[model samples]
Target: MKDDDKAVYLGTDCGATTSKVGAVWGDGTVVSTKLLQRVTRSQDGPAAVVASWVDAASDFLSQHDLTWDQVHGAGLAIPGPYQRYGVLDKSPNLPDTFTGFDVHNAYAGALADRAGRPIPLVVGNDGNLGGVGEAQHVRGRGHGTVLLLAPGSGLGCAFVDERGLPLDGDTLAGMEGGHVPIPLHLLGAKPYPCGCGRTWGCVEVYTTLSGLPYLLEERLEKYPDHELAKSGKPMKERAFALRTLAQNGDPLALEIFDFQAKALGIHVAVMAMAVDPRYVVIGGGLMDPEATSDAFRERYLGVVRDTALPLLWPAQRTTLTIVPASLGDLSQSIGAALVALYRSRS
Candidate 1:
């Protein structure tokens, strides 16, 4: 390959509370990576968040002693409900300022100003990008669809076909599986309001970190003697503490984990029935084996399999496998880089 053909690509993953910036060669070797917290805050406003992304990307290039001329293109992944052209329609986890923001143009313009020339940039849904990363991770495992499920501050879902490409079409809409409704009868407790401002329950309300408190509240009266009920810590802290207890074999904590796993399984089963993905790759803070416990991860997977298998059509039961994400938190950024490389090559 010529020097020009050895171009590097930039990728940015802007999540609700944090963002990641990195550069990678066309062959997928990571050049540099940085994890930034509070880089994009709805409260800080959309423009500020976009500026933060550009600053982070610039820093990544500088740290590596690289220049825009060496970068063939850039790709960004953001929390969505966005247009194919990169206009964010609305993001449930993001602030109202992002409702109609021209995210693609803003990032491209800012980076171009830094580069002193326009750079090709592409943007897509974060979860969809994650699917691309996970698909790449499991490329040789088999030839079938892969479902990427990210359960963190919120829940996200994406699909990748057998070719390891995101299954996006003309519209950037249907993949918002997080907002899929949860039948009232399936929800044992009062429906918790979603970040999207829906009063009725959605899969997100029971699967994300934000939903833990509501789940705990329902079980509080039942597990009055449990440590979670006696604690006065903040909801986030309490959620972690509960996970710790679950890891140590506490009955109440185990019950909570079981409930969450089952709820997640229902959503996964629905997706599997609809898409019939060969692998379901689970990612994000809530499901990380390192963040929680290996036992927790195992138990969660066991429950998911137990809940989903019987519900699956008899022949399809043996076709789907639920596993932890191979890329862990790096999925989105790597996927973004892959997108950039794909675009540049095309």
Candidate 2:
């Protein structure tokens, strides 16, 4: 690829609550990362959100003392289920109006208005891009396969092939991982409510921001008269207290977190068996070191090891290596920038 054809490698990651941008150099190094507050989806529709993205892009370029003329192409990492190809069906944290918006056309239009020149733009699902970034630059580079889990507002998954390419064309790999059914019987509990409006158990219904509230509320009911649950404090505030208590080594807090961790392990182990990935990189907003501590990781692994299910563990040394993503919070942007850099070459 000619240097001129390489473009600026402008990339954008429009997430549930944050939007980020970054630039990838010709040598595959990601530099000049920036993140702005998420657009207000409640008050703004898809058009307004894209407009905000344009504004953010302009600011990013100005901050770096760069010009639109230097940009060769742009790439976007958006949330999953791009309606029917390069479009969004629905984003829980984004405006509902974006359900059918054409991503390629929208971005091309936005950049043209801002730069006064047309540039090729491509879009991808954030989960798949996260997997790509981690596979190529973080944990699984040169490995056979990798599984990426974004465990925050929801549990997102992406399977990357040996070439560090996402398995699905673009959007199919990451949107439905959270919807995998869970066996309430194995959990030894009542069927939990899922965010998908079902009473059956699913990963996201208990693992996401929405699910955290439900988990906390159930615990609150169990200890209604406890100090943390007293007075008119919000349920979420009390939940934070539970987190604090867990950090401080409270038994009750440990129990609650353990239950959740075990549930997560079940999901991870299933994916591991299905793909036998070389590495599993975990990310997401709530994947803070605080929420998922070493003890939690150990417990999660214990559950995976103790499963009686077939092929849960093999005699051979398993090649799968689980690790936390090293990209910090700017991974989406870096992934997006890489997408732009590569697609422009193609």
Candidate 3:
């Protein structure tokens, strides 16, 4: 453990199911991260959410025999749009109680109350933090630009620069890469309605877990021999079964992910054209750094690499590296800590 007298900061990721708190040092080192189940969830409201982080940080400090005086700053990460730094605009994952909430106003006072002096704070989107966390995982420096694409409930995107700081546009953090217009569709496929109410042309329509069944429907109808062709299972159940079959190497299932990888690759290529990132890290529920175990995901990511790489210029192709995020779920919390450390220095 680091010296107790040294300055420490709390970096937190307030995710949908759990809240993660990280103790961070000046040099972007995450000393420890504690995961706390957020009981009652969004119904608990923003004040309760802030209180939980304080209490969690307090518990950690007390347990380690550390003093609040060592806590110099804090950082928070969450999903959805923000009005500005420390002010949430709206988050579908969160309750309306946080709508238009001035987080900077509340969080500053909360941290100050515990530290017995003013403590600085920074707020950011989780996806942006993922990029920050991923960049730190890379060894050494000169990582000019790092881009992270997370395909989970939806397609989550994060962008970080050579300095290991998120280049979040307007500090909203969540770049909403999912809603970017669809650049390509394959295998005679048509637009399969998106959650954003777009009937056509949204990358999310292909990348999201929730929308998978619909995406599979059009393809499955043509292949009557596919086991899932006439399945009566619910959407979630069908999606799971389809993935299971894909893992087992079913032809139709394998074909589905091939199509998905292409669409995902196209989306990433579109982003690359806008912001040329040297590193592309893909990790989430779908992919990871080492993927020998999950054959389906491994193959899918292979196609992603094959598709996105050739789209770049021959010189750019050799420079661009596509890999998976090493830190997994904790990346966001580590990122939040890094953001706090950076801001405190400034």
Pairwise lDDT winner, candidates 1 and 2: 1
When 1 and 3 are scored with TM-score, the better candidate is 1
The lowest-lDDT stretch of 10 consecutive residues in candidate 2 is 308-317
- For candidate 3, what is the lDDT? 0.74
| Model 3 misplaced regions, further than 4 Å | 1-5, 33-40, 58-67, 113-117, 171-174, 186-188, 197-200, 219-233, 240-253, 288-294
Error of 3 at 259 (Å): 2.9
How should the candidates be ordered by lDDT, best one leading?
Answer: 1, 3, 2
Residue 116's lDDT within candidate 3 is 83
Which candidate achieves the best lDDT against the true structure? 1
Rank by TM-score, highest first: 1, 2, 3
- Per-residue alpha-carbon lDDT of candidate 2 for residues 155-227, written as tens digits (9 for 90 to 100): 6677877765676654354436777876666667666676555577777665555566567666767777767
Give the C-alpha lDDT of model 2.
Answer: 0.67
Give a tens-digit lDDT track for model 3, residues 194-240: 66556766787677675678777767777887767767876557777
Between candidates 2 and 3, the one scoring higher on TM-score is: 2
Q: What is the lDDT of residue 318 in candidate 1?
A: 79
